[model samples]
Target: MILKKHLKSIMSVTLAVGLVLSMAVAQPNLGMAASADDETYSGKTPKYVFMFIGDGMSYPQVSSAEMYLGELSMPGQITPEQLDFTKFPVHGALMTQDSTSFIPDSASTATSLASGKKTLSGVINMDETKSIAYTPITEALKEKGYKIGIVTSVPITHATPAAYYAKVANRNDAYGIGKQLAASGFDYFGGGDFDQKTGPKGADQHIYEIVEGAGYTIANTNEEILALNNKSGKVVAIDPDDYEAALDYEIDRADGELALSDYVAKGIEVLDNSKGFFMMVEGGKIDWANHANDAAASIHDTIAFDESVEVALDFYRAHPKETLIIVTADHECGGMTIGYSLTGYSTHFDKLQPVKMSYQEFDKLVKEYQAAMPSDPMLSDLADEIEDAYGLDINNLSDYQSSMLEDAFEKAMSGEKPSDDQEKVLYGSYSPLSVTLSHIVNSSAGLSFTSYSHTGTPVPVYAMGAGSELFDGFYDNTKVYGKLSVITKLDK
Candidate 1:
């Protein structure tokens, strides 16, 4: 009996010793885990930060872009890299933009992301009481001795990009906003030219001159921009008006036409100081096309935006630890929703054709058809135009369908809703072709779009690099600004 007791005591001692040794080894790994929580920035200061905003992009937008590009591949669909902004190593969801109202405008949403605070609709970086509520991440970084740049496909003084550097009660205050942009002392500013002719009647006639006077070497062409040596603290602005005569998509092919990605790469090249730099690149036109209900055009622009992300991702591949890239949207426009199947339930979008014509092209065709016809042409005439543009044979469609389409077209021209049948055919009832195509794109490539207007839906945020850990779960849009500030340590 004594021997039995002795054996049990020996076993307990052995087990206790084993546990102590195991814990001792795990102590080092636990330190590594704790270090992950503490080590926000890598050893080197971030030499560069790129924030790409696809304005008005929600999950539906991303899905629509994917399905549009992939058609209806069943087994292995295309990946996000195939889209314009592609995919990120880390991603999270952002709250649906909400201001005083349920649906927030671009200005307020952008302001939230830029300043880490919610502001009123139509206001830039200002709160409901018309007070300048917050300082932007760019301003914070600039104060910390980092070069700053802001680029967008839309006008430079437009809502999203302007929120980063300008403070104003109204977004329409572009002329004044331009002056503030000039005075901000950012290293690079590129994109469409704002209609500075409208604000406050006889305001400053030389806002561009003001920008040039602020030690910025202003240029209109890509050649002049590329030729610039890093020594020149330059600000290059591309006037979209100068290229107005050219087709919108063709402008990028011009001698000086620069893609948004080109601006991003150039900004990085020029602002590669040892201290670091912060840049924002916006695919501004995706929202514009969606607002106009131009599915093809929106998909095309989404592809372009994805390409710009690829440029940043490539930069990260080379300097993974030193750069942080974040991609997100300000809000979603067009209330876009993806529908079920158009024909039968086959899980394939076979009826739709790849959209080749621009929204302008279809708009022009519809206008000419209306102008040339006598007073109130038959339903057949409108169907012919839609058939030619969409490559769908409406001849065999039900009389109800045909009538509905004609009525819808007439109402569209007159700026009114069409008859019931026409509304059903044009916008779809149980299954909308436009919305269905958007879903096919999403399901195929994990890209899908829902709705045609800015939805009260939340958008996704994708992040990568040293500070990406901050974008893990649901958070307010303002948190994005704070996260970037924390990761870059710009607040210091």
Candidate 2:
């Protein structure tokens, strides 16, 4: 009896100890659990990083663009060849942006990506107090002996492009930005003209001259850009103002004038040196058109932006493991939403042609229409002209649709609003027909568009090559800067 009792007591004690250990393991401390998942990433350091930012591109914009393109293909089907950046081996989403306010403007978001720090809205490469941030990826890359370049469809002094190089309290300080750009000592910079030479005569009327004097070759045409011998170490500036004439297309409506892809090709040509390079190519105008709710213009610009991605992908294919390419957007513009099935879903987007109207062309058309009707300041005449340009039939428009357009136009003409439904209809919103077509394409091609302005939502990020693994999960926008910095050895 004494032996049995001793054995039983020992068994009870062992069971009690086992239960205590189980409880301890089950209620692990938060810090310990976090540490358990923390992993050190080991991979080849990226020799080249190509970042493509499609300004104002939201998830909806990409989907819509894809659907639109797919509609143009056989049986309204899209293939790998039709995709601009589909070749990226790894893909994920990025937070749209985070500023002092939830809806971040381009200046803050771009600055965050460039400097690895968040700042107030409208600040570029500076903090909330307007002090320059010390950790710009460009500076970091330069410190590590990597060549750096920036290209964009909008003015080089625009927010997204300038954020990479210039520091300023306000993004509108284009003159100061331009001066800084000339002195940045970067190898390549190309884009449209900002109001660079707009002052009164002799009031420093030569910003291009300033750029040229700063050791850049100012080429006004693609031919000039093409003529540039690879041996020249000089910075090349393509005069975006004159690209249309050189290409034999009306500057007002030309589809390709210093296109993002073309600029990317040129950037690669110049910056692809022995030490490797870091290039940021932005389709900056997508946001501008989006803000105006110009659908045709925005979609066309998105397509152009995607073409630039194709250029980077070409480089990626050639370089394979040596290159890292990331395609993403700063934010979504116009609060663009994609679809509502009630609008007759049988139509597909493949039927529409890429819009060809330039801002100038639309302006000219509007003025002409206005001139034709002196008695009526209303858009009766202008509406007819717009219908002709866009192939719209007034008969098909519902009373509500017509009234909405008329009101929008009148407000625009009275200067109460910017240009009205002309800008919106031709480029911004899809008419019933267009929307129906979009749905059709979406059904077949897996594409569609939503809002017409930037949303508070996060955008997607598609990455490929070495160091791309770092971008696999949810991260702050500034973390992209750090990763790029480390990959390019900019952290040195």
Candidate 3:
């Protein structure tokens, strides 16, 4: 009873402190200490703003990536290598719950960030009733003569990016979202192409056709996009290779291919102007890789995301007093945790070095193997290929591990259904052989995932530059916009 009372007292004290911090931010002059002429909330608005969202990144994802890099550089040593954004001067936490559920989706959480409001999951830029639409900070900034750029590693019309410029009752309305993108009047839209060029039924006009008709230049090749400049009035730069889907995972990206950081750098080049610009860069593939429970892919993508933030950091150095950079996430996906049952209190992130490709790439390899071996292929027959792909020596596996592979291999090759509940747990929706491979490799690295969906976890917020001090406290995701509005006074 005494211990319970002490715990209650601690909770009470923490809540009271949080309330005090929130109240402090409510004051108009709580901006960072700066000169009278400095462009802070107390003075003029910041001229440049960059919002970097690592789609599924949270504390575990961030720490794991740092640890992986540290292990790669100093094998078996306890060095702590960190991402650039983590070293920002100010940090806070965001409660990601939307109006409806504790577990939030990208659309709703992103809406909360873009606009100071909460909506239902899968809804974008609209209230829960869907009758009233909320204007995102991007619109307000645009009205203030700031060019807006939206860049992502996923589809341009994906939920996270769309929340800034599009409003739809359902996120699946790809054609509608694409139309909104064409009409958004933003300066730049770079990354993946329209997920659905035509309507869902394939009867409507192509979105690209609409985009071209709306007077936007479309760059589909590397040379075409690289040649673009600030003079290239309005632009939509699509990934030359992955035109229909997301950009390649960092682990699978080929040399010279346009990565997320490339798009962000290009955005900086094109969006720079006298009045300034607001750019939203998303490392979206991190979420997809985590959803598939691929730790190596997730880590590489997280690193790639940090590289994009570094691009902004470089820009900030040139315009320190006039720039603001914020790094955050929509929500945490996959319930990712750093520790694993097999390696308690120890992590061998270097073991992940052998994972040369992502689970998606490995699935293609499985398909090729299946096609090459028409007759009944056995698990033992692909031992050499397994070793080559994931560096997992199949010959050295214990009987129990071999049995698991045999079951997954048979189901993958022969199109056999799981015999019971245990097999279902072994492989859910994903290719059985591929998921099993990821599970084994991830376990070897001392990482694990609890769910294949978004979790009810609060995401981190890292900020720096003008008015960054206002972000140094726990708050709801909606307060992200509220804080930005305070800095720029745009909502007024």
Clashes of each: 32, 28, 0
Q: How far is candidate 1 from the true structure (C-alpha RMSD, Å)?
A: 11.4
Alpha carbon lDDT of each predicted model: 0.67, 0.66, 0.87
The candidate, 1 or 2, that scores higher on lDDT is 1
lDDT order of candidates, best first? Answer: 3, 1, 2
Ranking by TM-score: 3, 2, 1
lDDT of 1 by residue, 353-419 (tens): 4444555555566667668865766545655555655554557655554554454545555644334
Of the two candidates 1 and 3, the one with more favorable TM-score, higher being better, is 3
Cα deviation of 115 in candidate 1 (Å)? 0.8
Give the per-residue lDDT digits (tens) of candidate 2, residues 1-492: 999999999999999999998877743121111121233445776777888898888777777766666656644454312456654666777664554666788888887677767777788877666764534678768777778888877777888988988898988888878888888888787666644553334377477778888888777666787665446575655655543211111214354455567778887888877788889988877786666555555667778788878887888888888889888888788766555343444444543353345443556666665566667675565546555445445456556556655655664455432346654543354232223222232333223344444677787788888778777677557667766655654334
Which of 1 and 2 is the better model by TM-score? 2
The TM-scores of all predictions, comma-separated, are 0.77, 0.79, 0.91
Residue lDDT tens for model 3, 202-230: 99998999998898999989999998889
Q: Which of the numbered candidates is closest to the native, going by highest TM-score? A: 3
Question: Model 2 — TM-score against the truth?
Answer: 0.79
User: Which candidate wins on lDDT?
Assistant: 3
Model 1 weakest 10-residue run by lDDT: 27-36
Residue 344 lDDT in candidate 3: 95
